[model samples]
Target chain A: MLDSERLATDSKPNILLKGTKEGLLLLLNEVVSFESLLEDLSTLIHGEKKSLFEGPDLKISVDYGERVFAASEIREILDCLAKRENLILREWGPSTAAKLSLFNSSRKFGPQTLLKGTVRAGQRPVFEGDVVVIGDVNPGAEIVASGDIYVLGRLRGIAHAGFLGDWSAIIAAAEFAPMQLRIADIVSRAPERDGKPLRTFMEFAYLKEDSMAVDKLDSLHAWTAMARQSS
Target chain B: MGTAIVVTSGKGGVGKTTSTANIGTALALLGKSVCLLDADIGLRNLDVVLGLENRIIYDIIDVISKDCKLEQALIRDKRFEHLTLLPAAQTKDKSILSPETVKELVGALKELHDFVIIDCPAGIELGFQMAVSGADRAIVVTTPETPAVRDADRVIGLLEKEGIRNPHLVVNRIRPQMVKRGEMLDIDEIVQVLAIDLLGIVPDDETIIKNANKGEPTVMKPDSKASLAYRNIARRILGESVPLLSFEEAPGFWGKMKKVFGAK
Candidate 1:
């Protein structure tokens, strides 16, 4: 926890800031009026907003804490919070802090999945963890996982494997035709519906590889064995 | 858990608005309170397709800008008592509508309606985003032609980008004979290329135009080929497992003649 991130609740279901490993402290309380909460947070942060963090990076994840929020309302809040990240990031991660520290240069979290299902046009799934499938990701379908992703099916829709920007994550699909795939801060688009497809069941994608490489899944048995043995 | 569907396509004149009007009406006939909002703004045509154009005294723009109450802007259809139309403004006031506004409107409307069917425009713009802003899912409508299908694929990608999960695909204007004769794109092929879940496939029928002219959406047109298909789609949206309707029209003249005349 960062020294600057203090915990407070006002003894009510209101906005409270708690900084975690992911960075910007967010205490989401839907009971309080959103406008009043925003006004209060802005006022509280006004004095120390600049010196709040040493680096220009942060992320805010508002958990509704079991409140049933309209999806549109959620979208609105997220869009606004993301803009603040562009101007000044309040979240702090080990990698982010490591980048600023001249000690080392490496990332972690490589365990991921690639799923392939015939995601029908109107079907959508938001996976905040690792996901893997072996079916066609249909058009109009959505996949938003916060971990890693691998699809044995044609990816022609929208997929965001590391939506929260877990930099160690990566995604690899068999045909790789998604309209968009957001892994960490890097987002790659198919550009068009037509593209050359690979027919390999084995492909390895990770931050170490830096690019998606198509191959036989079994070819990386040694890595799998090592990964399994490490645990 | 109610479904929010934005009927959209990349190519114009592919019957997106028509399909939306018909499907919403048909779904309402199934006993769901359906709110069909025209998100096309400047080029709104859903009212015309549903024959509710004259009934619109107020539009979504009116409700948002506080010119009129939301209930007043909602034009209830006499034909299907459960159906209502939040018509698009004929004037240019709706041009400045934002995503948040669209979302809030959808939320307020959804409480009163079971299914909120937004008729999206042909291109990706603020209007289109506004329509999809509150969508939990969607149905991308497309014709069986190359350009339409290609555009559908692109639109599907866009939906994914916008974080719309559970998007169903509807193939409109499909000519089975053309597909069987190797002259048109087939269902499996398009599905393979686009790689999404199939919702309902609608056939190309001449009644579509006639229905549009009468402002009687085809989904409710008793025995029309397209109407039946839209009905099946509504059932699917209601979570019923209806068998996929076959568009493989019985082989044409020469082939049928060959069978009758004992010729190969």
Candidate 2:
């Protein structure tokens, strides 16, 4: 075999998939490019299909050493792995010392999408998990997150949190005058306040007794505390 | 060495052909060599609107089918010395020309002209793809209405997806009276909904029909607001920062009195 082919088929592949107590830990070679790493990982999973996944389905966690990836890039890697039916991606993050502690504490955290600029009109950004927007959601834009949504700026567009019927998901923003808001299956329109100045305050929306309710975010800590007690 | 711009409106009758004609004429008037390609095959109207329909001996189909050279298909406009038109074949189907042919034709045209303005078809289909194939920039035209604005929004989204960044918007046929009466959507609302840079605003003018029927671009008429608007748009396209034209009419006696007295 050629030298490159020999290196490619070596026992210590670029992607190391080992069975661990925490299910499966996917350790990627930091030296390889991201694209090549993905290609090798795909080939490895497909090549070792029967023996590697002979038992029950298991969650696979990826540990990338010292490399930081954007939310979308990480999601793309996880999605590539998810195409294989035998593997379920539970979580993946940089294996920094700080994050390693969080990995040990909780392993059930799902994906989250973080968008930095204003979501403009005609732009629809959909996320599978929690979404955090650093800027405004202008009218004619829409954000659909399967989990909670937190916007650092004004929300004037359509925001659908708990899109998959998770009623506990909440929508929070610095300013909460949205054209239309939806939490799960329920839809609500912003009430018209003619001639009245809009309340310039932070607000959050959640389902209270099966009805959508908007509350001032000033008491957000108390609200979460109350919810913790109720749950 | 010329820029190719594709003028498109996802929904028809929002004035893509008219805008292309006027902008091309305006550019040619500014001493730039301009070629307007009518990409709306089987439904070509740019030639008719530009008043060069009778002068077309070889169409773009002839040029593409190798029956004629690219220069043979180009018809010179009598009004503007620098202006030229490549009329589409009315009898040919849109499928006759693929995106590759358009890219090749535009590449050739770019070497001969300062600007190659393509008039795209109505829908987001093969025709639209062919028109925008070699375009370095895009111009999306829409009227101040909900349906037009909605389609323009979709077109802008598609343009961005196709890697056409910063597609300029031309809100056409805006009625200032209806806007003041709150019956029609305003330019600001349309611009807000489209979320694109404002290129120009053409007021609803009967002169457009009169000039178009005469096979003349409205911009050639010195007194027409639509003409002035198109000129400003051409200037803007040439990297000149021109203030957006106001469509509002001068306040009348009662309006001026109300303004002076601070009355509603």
Candidate 3:
């Protein structure tokens, strides 16, 4: 019965597993108490036995072995291991079956994605790489980084992507409102806080013709390609 | 050593120039060597405020460009023996004074005077940067309003980023009676948000206007609250800890009856 819950079809520890259309969901499993379980699990994760918290962000679904512990304890152990490795844990909860829908559902393969959390007042997001946040960036928040930026929500805060002078950088969000936007050296600010709202499916923003431009996200690939070419 | 103090506010028209001019005159009247450098560039007014507009044979640009010597560009204050003015060039804006050039000017002036005061332009432009760049310390001036304090916080952040060692706050145009009623942003509130040291609190004083018109600074007056406040700031710059002065309404007779009767 335990092995049934344990989806260790591959030589992965199966601590964190989620089936994605792109690839097998895997995560670093470091909290297993038994030395042998840690070793076996480590081998399964990398195919070559190694310690946890190494490599890039991986999507993982927990394979509950026959010997089960409290759900909360598992979360806590994962959180502790993440903290030790300077990693941010994005949880798709294990308790409720609603979250399981996300576990079983197919997620699109992407280099990365923008988060959807609200950018509240006084909060800031400054990343060194590409960022795509799926939520609204509120007023008084700031986003500064050295790569491309995309916001699937309102880009109201001060967003400065490509601060290190990558002119090909872009900032696209669902809504086209932002207090100030900067791609490379070009800067633009929403003149009036009271701007018309956009109820749209998707939007794209990037440095175009020496300034910032907004367009449909579906049409992003062409210009983004051009942006890279011109640079 | 001479003190180079930059009076700045991130927002415009918060009495930065007025405070700098008055305090420069005040410190000079106390017999300290003082130089007031107006970094406002195109909007120069320290000369006008000091009533020395007619004596501008050479400007700060002349001194920096070495077109004329620093001594010739310096306008001597008529009233104070030790005070001098470095008027901003009428044609040039703040961009003319690069950070390196500004540091050189102030560093040179610091050797010759007891206080080298700079009048900063509003906002974080090249002028504001120049005004504060050569400062040994900074005096962040703010009014009892929201925009002023918010901008002041921005200035504080920039100053801290530039590695300015000591930054002090000066609460200007405070209406204490309103503060007592929660009608105004009190000194404590502004200080808390900026998280800086408080040098002094200046109340709204009518005599200040009269003094400005007469080309006199309140710092020379003994009993004036504004004068006392400036003096306190001066002493603080001199490495002395001074207590803040509060303006108490005349505690005498008719004041009480007027309050009780709600009289104007």
Candidate 4:
């Protein structure tokens, strides 16, 4: 838990502005609408623009709660922060306690099935726990796992991770060339390749903002929560 | 006891029958006793390909139904002294050959021959099941096309499930010129995609058509590239280390020298 010091006291303040050694910390209330929060943040910054700060340079750390932010939402926040002259948004993340709770939420329930051959066409392997395959999942094959799916080879088939609706479940592969990917209830289709081969060492798909998001292991920093906990 | 090897492809028109007849003939040519069994039942074609159709007085159904002795149904190939074929019944359905009957027939063939090569029908149906029922190993025949490769992958999966591990692959009808032009899948691409041990790559040659029409396998034409490829496949199946033939019959040395000198 951060030492959240409330700098403003509205009747029901959804945006908390706090003073830190580095910069101002903006702790957003998870229950409030993002539009209202952003509007409130803007009003507070400009309302006391003359007396609140001394220099033109400003640094901020936006702390989100249990809500998983989307890429668009993060971009929105960054855009809002750039509105201030000479501003640098240092970090944005969920509370440490929320992250810990998320880790504990998706626990291993049963033994994982480890397969060493290609899952071919017209074949589907449905497993209750983690499913790991050391071979390619060819097109027309479907693999459904209640937990995570780690394909050590090319994945050109359909993969459904957390099929029973566990949002924390992930699906990863060496070559992320799936026809379709699903994490929990969120589904994503593979983007049309531009006739150029993508050199993906390892990529994982997870639920982000009620949608399936795929990120390469190289660009792992974008997925702060997952990058923190090695899977 | 002889080893029963089933030549199969999940999709049709991928040269399963051609591979069977050629490889079986090649094995017999290598001084090994081989028995080729056509397990396609009503769609029988191995006998026609082997030119043994005119002498088919008793068929496999006659042997299975105890209407004739097993040796009575065997037809000796005229080209090879050690080669024999137990032809499939052209009129019967695939359901007549149960898994048990296939196993028993393969066992009986094993007692008399060094190699029993079964030509499995296309598609993973009852005919395919009966073909691979008693096999100790398998050879998956596939073309460079997407449908053939996809079905071959499925058949490989089924073979593994049946405890047939590491089935070899033969990519047939590969055109070196088309592969060079990047229009067709190469042998390496097919092997990589299927992730199986490659037995051989048979180049697309007109000799195959000629041999088939003449009721002789391409392996009979020793100078043909497809025949040499089949012989290499047979050698590999016999636990011999035979290097893969380079299907890169591109423009010859004279053409390369001409290009180097900028000669017309």
lDDT string for model 2 (B130-188, tens) is: 99898999999999887787778777777877889889999899888898888888777
**What would the C-alpha RMSD of candidate 3 be, to one decimal place?**
14.1
TM-score of chain B, per candidate? 0.93, 0.94, 0.91, 0.95
Using DockQ as the yardstick, the better of models 2 and 3 is: 2
Which model scores highest in TM-score? 4
Docking quality (DockQ) for each candidate = 0.05, 0.13, 0.04, 0.43
Question: How many Å off is the CA of A173 in candidate 4?
Answer: 1.0
For candidate 3, chain B by itself scores a TM value of: 0.91
**Which runs in model 4 stand beyond 4 Å of their true positions?**
A1-111, A219-231, B93-95, B250-264
Worst 10 residues of 2 chain B by lDDT: B186-195
Q: List per-candidate RMSD values in Å.
A: 20.8, 15.8, 14.1, 12.2
Query: Model 3: per-residue lDDT, tens digit, B1-264?
Result: 677888998899887877897778767766689999888888877787678888898887888888898888888888876789988998844345687898889888898898899999998977777888899889889899978877786787677667785688888888778888877977875765566788888888888778777666767677778877888777777778877886677766888888899997
Please tell me which model should have the higher DockQ, number 1 or number 4.
4
Instruction: Give the per-residue lDDT digits (tens) of candidate 4, residues A71-102.
Output: 89778777766666666777678763333344
Give the alpha carbon lDDT tens digit for every residue of B1-264 in model 1.
356789998788888898899899889889999999899888778999889888878888878888888998899997988899998877756655899988998998888988999999888777778888998778988777867876786677678889975678898888878887877777888766676789999898999999899998887767877889999899998889999887656779888989999987
How does each model score on lDDT? 0.72, 0.84, 0.72, 0.84
**Best candidate, DockQ:** 4
RMSD in angstroms between candidate 2 and the native structure over all alpha carbons: 15.8
**Which whole-number lDDT from 0 to 100 does residue B4 have in model 4?**
92
Q: Over 4 Å off in model 2, which ranges? A: A1-109, A116-124, A134-142, A151-157, A173-180, A185-203, B248-264
